[model samples]
Target: MSQIPMFRESFQHASKELLHWFPGHMAKGLRVMQQKLRSMDGIIEVHDARIPFSGRNPLFEDRLASVRPHLFVLNKIDLADMSRKDEIVSRLKYEGVTEVILTNLKNGQDKASKEIVSKMIDMIKSGTRFDRAMTSPSSYNLLVIGIPNVGKSSLINRIRTVHTKREGKAAPVGAEPGVTRAVQQGILVNIKPKVYILDSPGIAQPRVNNVVEGMKLALCNIIHDHKVGIDIVADFLLFYMNKAADFRYVKAFNLDNPTDKIMEVLVKIAVDQNIYHKVKPVTGGPWMEKLNLEQAAYFMVRKFRSGELGKICLDSDQLPTHTTATLSRQRARSR
Candidate 1:
């Protein structure tokens, strides 16, 4: 019988520029979001559940969240493994985050999405409204904020559907980041307590400090695919899967066996799909056509995002107090 190949312990991209993707629109959006924060009653920050521990913009907390009632929602819970939800929540609490919610924002009927409005009402009622409290207003205004492509728009649309039974999208949703360019004017989502929400563009940090953190964002598709080459992203995905000891991709991609070489894998994908590109010889010889490795890499990355390989939590391997306690109990029983 053939033995399984050894997997990689870590991933390193060829070009480690650190995936800093702050576009011009984000700069303007941040300014606009802060300007509208004074009239806002509460703030909701959305983030991808796959990489809950990293890739968050610290500027949101420093500039907008301090004065407002902040709610952190880890969206896309269906795409993430929630077995360690308590551990994830515990880590956030330690970092001074008291209000956090796990939600599948794409689903309008989800209980968590419905609870968002109620939670916002509770937070606003319990918290001070700053100088705006001088005027007794019957309605509440909320600002939805987060990093790129984390589903801020999708959440707003879902909430709007849940409460108002709205037939259409209140905000534009896209797979790519920065879909919402500017801070949208007040959008009515609930009528009972009179709630209005402002949707803001997804802003990224000026710099990504860690390479792994950048890779996580790229893999989760928070960063644009072209900025960080698809090959590099796919390579990191393969390395990450192998590091986690998951080989679901081998069968998904129809590979004979697992291999650490990214080009080898992309070549197979290209051959299987008949994807190719024309290339001229460097020596000025006849133009040579070759397999489109970049396209193949992108295909592989897309499949992973669509959950074709299998269900996975990119950050689930992170062990915390909850995991340690379980490990301790198991050890005791084994002894």
Candidate 2:
């Protein structure tokens, strides 16, 4: 079966804001997340394959450190580079995360993925060298978390293969943030039923709490907020796409000159595709290239996300060295 298309909802500022939560709801959710963390033999931490770091719940690891033996679920592998995904899984394992599962939940029935999940669940039940539960067939609770628009619900739907209320509307997919407001649970059963996974609401990183983090998120998405213009967001994407496309690809497109400016490369693509509109200058010097580069970048990301870019993954190998301490310092200055 063909892979299901992923749905995305933009939560550009939700991560930074104190997410509006009723006192009772906040207390209840935390109690549930913590309670589930305790009784369960193992935890499954789900993240988007594209932006793994950004998709991480900033507060989750610390909250569940005591609940040892968690599986790192990297979903949407189809949108990322296979080699880079391998490298990331290895790096994460080296960084104290032992059990990692790579899956393109869009195509859940794929046999290899089923085997990976089975083996990982077996390992989770078997107990790891560092795990506290070395002698038991304990119940497992998988906590599926990620940034907004990373296909959490779609994955759940695929795994369960049914349309339920928690899955929401069926015909038209949502493209806005917080579609899955509360936590929902589902059972994963094949041959023997033994694992449960929770789909949590998308948690976004707050707006450019710092300039650098802000830029990273903006580069990935064409964000629109009072603080930044659509042009700047578009410009950032253009820069990254040009930097990412191989030299051979660039030369094939007849863009042989070396320039760090993303706008220049975009201009070349616009001209080559004949996407430019000619507007005569009153001074009669020349007709300016009328194509909007920002729109081009937006479409490029859309194409990339939709897999029309031919399995291309952008900037997946580089790891950001920004530490929590550095982020905290930058946040303090912003305050």
Candidate 3:
């Protein structure tokens, strides 16, 4: 653990305002999802396994989840420290989550792919199919939902490849958040059980109530980097790395000790890795190359997201123990 007294006690954003990042597409996608609930047999709510608790939209619980059989899939497990997964799952179950799944969702077939397909089929077999009334189809229709860039598309593609005998992406995938701009329907993943998935645009809350949660989401690439500001995200990454006592970054970037200051780290990364920016004055001066801190921070954040800095769980120390609604209210009140 970071020595609390040695490092900064808390992270404070300069804005001191709520981080609200709902775009036009998210609002429209949500409306589309609520209308499609009657068509869904089950729900697979994907989240970053590193942030098992943060960045989930409580509105999803209120508007869409109540009427469906829900399964929470915490994705990106390859980049998370699962030492406390039992505690995480138990706490989620305590909050009345029907089921929780941990997934790695990589380029090739993995155990998680098969497990997700099997479990969803089982949930459809056993759990209630809400608003579909008495009649149900032989194949299952599952809706995939989560905050942005938590690997929802990757999960669907993995299941499709492993179970459906398909060879390519059924849904679009990208490195940045908000790549999924629309709610697409009937992405088939299985032929034997006749399973199909509906991929929805990732939705964030209108306002992120807590700054720490917002920082964590930004660090995990769930929020757009530009929207959160790369410097702030890098600072949070430094803070959490110290808090977790994960010094892999020190070796990764050839630093002597852990840093709480992101600027120093970013500059060092730029110097060591030769990252720079070309600038030309509006007055028509010659172009000059300068060490770019933002680019370096982006590089560092990518390292964390890609697991190059080492396996870290940004949310393990801060999992929400209370129900989603209760925590939402508490966070709102604090704001």
Candidate 4:
């Protein structure tokens, strides 16, 4: 009989400093966003669905969202685990989030994407600033904001296509973080209510809370892979999957079995993918051919991002077992 091997119970990284990534553009963008806040009727803050409870910029909540009708659009729903969707929504609601929507912007015609404009308009009309919005009844201005690479630009383009029936992209988009360097002028989307959305650059927190949080951000590509080392990012992903008992990678990468060692996995990936580079020996002899583990690490992380492994929620552990409403009812019943 064969025995199952034990995996890591937790992940560890040497440096947490690699997680802090607030560049000059982010600071400048924050200032520009604040300047434009007075003109916006509402806020649509986009975030990665896989990381509903992680990597969100607190400054948005403290400075921008509180002053307007804010809606959290968790983008990339296609790649997230929806099994706990109810718990996620309930927890967000308990945390004082008035509105939340899960969406996959890649599908321009997705039901959630189609409903965004209407949802924002409804929120603006029913909010404390409805009278202010009424003053400009012909049009509503909204700002799309969030940490980098969570699809803020993509959302604007999707919304434009849905509302205006436009074929071309209204805002620029890229797979990498910090694609949009500054706030741009509003692009008109709806003709009836006259919706205009201003796309803003992704803003990350100046200091990350911890190394694990940083790794999560890196895994989502919110931070550059090199900042935290691609190898470390891949290692953390392995640990996370193993801890959750997810072994899809074994089949995905053609591994004989699951193992806690990242080097072994990367070596296998490198060999299987034919990723190699020439290396010079320290003894001043001839250069030798070696497997490129760095490239292999990147490939592994990319697979996870592309949903080849399976649906996953990085914040699944953070969700409350009992919702606030349930706890209240329980307390009342006990009395």
Candidate 5:
């Protein structure tokens, strides 16, 4: 429940109605973000530690290569699979990112933030000192980039200690998934060279096949938005849990006969949660109507990343095509 995004009404409806509705706005935002990125000395690339690959932006990678050096930040380590932290760390390093820093950026602890800042300084002084010398009045600039809802704004708020900014004045940082649709700067003064952190919009992965698959990759749990039960999420978790952990998840939930069909599994969960009201809709009355069980199961497995499920990595792998991929393959055949 705590993992649920804020402003539940809008998110719930948006999740249900427009989960796959990514428009040109993201492409437009990416262009703007790249334009703004030219000023920064390095990128503080944020990814969900749990799903690093999915959060990466290939466009950002290509665009930023010429602009600045990058510090790949694997954030939200607190919520990640404790057992696999070393493996995740190793995997990221293997992915051509040597300066990976594990952090719980949203919680705003000073120790982690300070270490992040220190790491940035060390990297800059080593490789970016000559670049810094060229600017007339250069301040230390770091581009904070990530996918939507990956805790970028929350991290900024914690670092600066300033809350919402006033109208027509410099705004205090706030946390919305895509809050910084256009890039904005936040100043942190403690560092010797003043730190100018560029907060950018969350970047969307390029559609691999069609928009629907892209939606599934970006928003996640698209089926849960349209459906009432957590069955899809459960099935997804069960499917991946077994893959990642090398054992099925049915034993944890105690479902003797596990079905691959999400709806079938959801019915079992409804019975287990003891809130399944047959007289009412399958959504389980008003209280559970908006509940997203698929997301819930993902959250539980996320809480304990024991590798019992299959390697359930969402991002940081091959870009997924899903429905969009299927459509693209079909189009290619026709061509």
Candidate 6:
């Protein structure tokens, strides 16, 4: 029988500065969101499902969630391990989140995507702030907010397509972070009991919690790859997957076996895929062809993001082993 390979128990990196990413646009976006808060009846905060427990901007809860009925849409569920979804929802509920929905916004016909409109309408009607909304009974305005590249714009566009049957995108969508720079004007989504959604820029917390947390965000493309270093991010991905006993990347990257060293994997990927660059020697000799480790790193990370590697949940370890009710019962029994 083939023995299982052992991997690193923990991840180590040189500096935490790579994880810190708070641009000028993020600050401006926060101010604009605060200004528009009073006009909104409810909030829909979208996030990446893979890192459900990581990288959430706490400011959203302190400044926005407290005043309004907030619904969390964990987008990109297609790329996440749905088996642990119940635990994720339970943990979120414990953290004061009243409503949570797992969705894949890329699919226009997705059931969860279709449910968002009705869900928001219901939350608005049932909320204590409904009387304030009655002043403008015909329309319900909701603000879409979350950290960068969690598909805030995509969620708005998907909802618009579902309710209004409009094929054109109301908000621009991009694969990279910082796509939406400022709060956009409300776009009409539903006709009767008219519903309009305000698309706000993705706001990331100025400081990340820790290196591992930042790595999760970086791996999910919430933070720019260059900021955290692509090679370093790829290493974290390998470390995370290995610790989870997931070796799907070995097949995805065409490696003979699972190994902990990221450089070995990158070298193999570069050689097998013919990803190389011409480098000039310091001695001024002829240009030498060397493997492009950077390109290889990007290719590896992109595959994971696109769900080519496999469906994974970065916060699987953080999920509660027992339900909140069960834990409460155990505590009561102990007492």
Please report the candidate that would top lDDT against the real structure: 4
If the candidates were sorted by their TM-score against the true structure, best first, what order would they fall in?
A: 6, 4, 1, 3, 5, 2
TM-score: which is higher, 3 or 6? 6
Please give each candidate's TM-score. Answer: 0.88, 0.61, 0.87, 0.91, 0.64, 0.92
Worst lDDT run of 10 residues, candidate 5, spans 4-13
Candidate 5 vs candidate 6: which has greater TM-score? 6
Cα lDDT tens digits, model 2, 169-224, are 32122444456565665455322344566666655543334443454444434122
Q: Please rank every candidate by lDDT, starting with the best.
A: 4, 6, 1, 3, 5, 2
Q: What is the lDDT of residue 301 in candidate 1?
A: 94
Candidate lDDT scores, in order, read: 0.82, 0.51, 0.80, 0.87, 0.52, 0.85
Question: Candidate 6 on 1-335: residue-level lDDT in tens?
Answer: 14557899888884656555788988888888898998998999999999887878999999988799999999999899877678789999999899998898767568998888888888887887688645548788889999999998888888888788899878989999999988899999888778999998888878887788888988999888878799999999999987766777877787777789999999999999999999999999899999999999999999999999868888977876656765464334322
In terms of TM-score, how similar is model 4 to the real structure?
0.91
Candidate 3 lDDT over residue span 1-335, tens digit each: 23323567688874433387788999999999988888888888998888887777888889887777888988888898786788889987876687887777774656766788778777776765433463445677889999888888988988888876778888999988888899897798988768889999999888876888888888888777777788888888888776654567777888766677888899999999999999997889799899998889888988988898867777766764546664464334322
In candidate 1, which residue ranges exceed 4 Å CA deviation?
Answer: 14-19, 129-137, 278-289, 321-335
Error of 4 at 81 (Å): 0.6
TM-score of structure candidate 2:
0.61
Model 5, global lDDT: 0.52
Kindly report which residue pairs in candidate 1 clash with one another: none
lDDT of 4 by residue, 32-120 (tens): 99999999999999999999888788899889999999999989999998778988888878766889998997675689988989999
